[model samples]
Target chain A: MGRVVVEVMPKPEILDPQGKAVVGALPRLGFTQFTSVRQGKRFELEVDGPVTPEVLAAAEEAAVKVLSNPVIEDVVRVADIEADAAATITSEGLA
Target chain B: MGRVVVEVMPKPEILDPQGKAVVGALPRLGFTQFTSVRQGKRFELEVDGPVTPEVLAAAEEAAVKVLSNPVIEDVVRVADIEADAAATITSEGLA
Candidate 1:
């Protein structure tokens, strides 16, 4: 199986009030060195086969269409990881 | 100021108990297709200047050293962002 890592972030030039609030809350959360917080989500899916480029692209498109808000969100990064080496190496070689 | 985005993930080889639990909970959480969850953390820093390669590398190192568990955690990815064009372009050129 392969895993896709999607990184969702606020668009540049926009102010992140939630991020600011989280940053402000850090010191109280027992982290004195915590200067800021960038809120995002992490998801792992057990898809069939290895991390083919097509699979990675599809997952990311799915993430954007279903999981994220386009207006506020910036680009979503897709990292495809295959659990099994034999399939993964073959997929990578094809790519 | 620039924003540094840090992504932390569990080690690939290790079994993720939390991930399993989260995956089990997804259907109940209104996600019929939601298969799994790999938890991670995100941090944003208001660094001076643009996204120089050195700064991004340093942030990743700091994240590994201070914020993550070496035994269980795998790798930390750092992305540096500069607000102003004047600084970021120069830094990118340098990299």
Candidate 2:
């Protein structure tokens, strides 16, 4: 199987309260070197076969339609992963 | 300045309702090749300098403490981006 990774992030004009909270909490936690923090969403979809152009297109459509709210958010990145090799086991599982 | 990207995902043992909803919606949307979907969080932190090892460590700590609930989620990946180069402009901005 192949895997498609889609990243969804809020538009720059939108206010991200969760991200703002994290940014606000940082200084209280004693780390104050950051200028800004933007939080978003990531979706990992495992397909039934090797990733192809058609799959990517379909995934993109799904990501735009189902994964994010286009009014306030956008799809930032879409990546293909080889399930047979790099995806069967979690990287943390190895550790 | 530099940037750090942190990806936070639910632990394998934890339940992901948002992911489940997406998986359920895909078939209705005419795309049904996925076995599963896992939704997660991504944080893009813009720092004021180059991303050093210390910066990565601090970002990791913040990701763990402020960004995710360690009881149910985990940090999957931590990436460093160069602010002076590719990070200066959005890839979509060129379009």
Candidate 3:
């Protein structure tokens, strides 16, 4: 199976109450280095075969049209999961 | 300023009703290639200076301790936003 990852974030001008809440809470939790926080959404989509360009195109279209609200959010990324390996931490390692 | 991006996902064994709803809705929206979908959270933490190793480490700690629930979610990634430039689509480009 192949997987595509999509990331969406709120527009810079938008007010993110959730992020504000997190930033407010972090200092109390002793993580005081962060000055601000912005919360967003990540999605993983699975397909039966390799992630072809056609699949990526479809995913991108879906990301913009269905996965995010253009008025408030931006489709920041749409890519094959393999391309994200360097950044992804497997749950086993954390376990 | 520097930004750290953190991604958190629902554990594979966990029931992701939001993902299921998306997967079900996709076909209706004419996106049929995807077989499954998993929804997750992405956070961007901002700091006043360049992202040092110490900042990255702190973000990772916050990702696990405050951003994610170990029982149902996995802290999949915690990286400098610069490292994500290749995948990130600036809103201006989309516009």
Top candidate by lDDT? 3
Against the native complex, each candidate's DockQ, computed on alpha carbons, is: 0.16, 0.39, 0.40
The numbered model that scores best in TM-score is 3
lDDT string for model 3 (B1-95, tens) is 99999999999999999999999999999999999999999999999998888898999999999999999999988878875663333321332
Q: By summed lDDT, which 10 consecutive residues of candidate 2 chain B come out lowest?
A: B83-92
Scored by Cα lDDT, where does model 2 land?
0.78
Tens digit of lDDT per residue, candidate 2, span B14-68? 9999899889999998988888999999899989877877887899888888888
Model 3 chain B lowest lDDT segment of ten: B86-95
Weakest ten-residue segment in model 3 chain A by summed lDDT: A86-95
Overlapping backbone residue pairs in candidate 2 total 0
Q: For residue B54, give model 2's deviation from the true position in Å.
A: 1.8
Candidate 3 lDDT (Cα, 0 to 1): 0.88
Global fold similarity of model 1 (TM-score): 0.51
Each model's chain A TM-score: 0.67, 0.82, 0.90
Q: Best DockQ goes to which candidate? A: 3
Q: What is the C-alpha RMSD of each candidate to the true structure, in Å?
A: 9.0, 5.9, 5.0
* Least accurate 10 contiguous residues by lDDT in model 1 chain B: B83-92
**lDDT score, candidate 2, position A4:** 82
lDDT for every model?
0.56, 0.78, 0.88
Share of native interface contacts recovered by each model: 0.22, 0.65, 0.60
Off by over 4 Å in 1: A8-39, A50-95, B13-15, B28-36, B81-95
Candidate 1 structure quality by residue, lDDT tens digits, B1-95:
55666666788777878678756764654444445567665556655565555655556665676556788885545554322223333322332
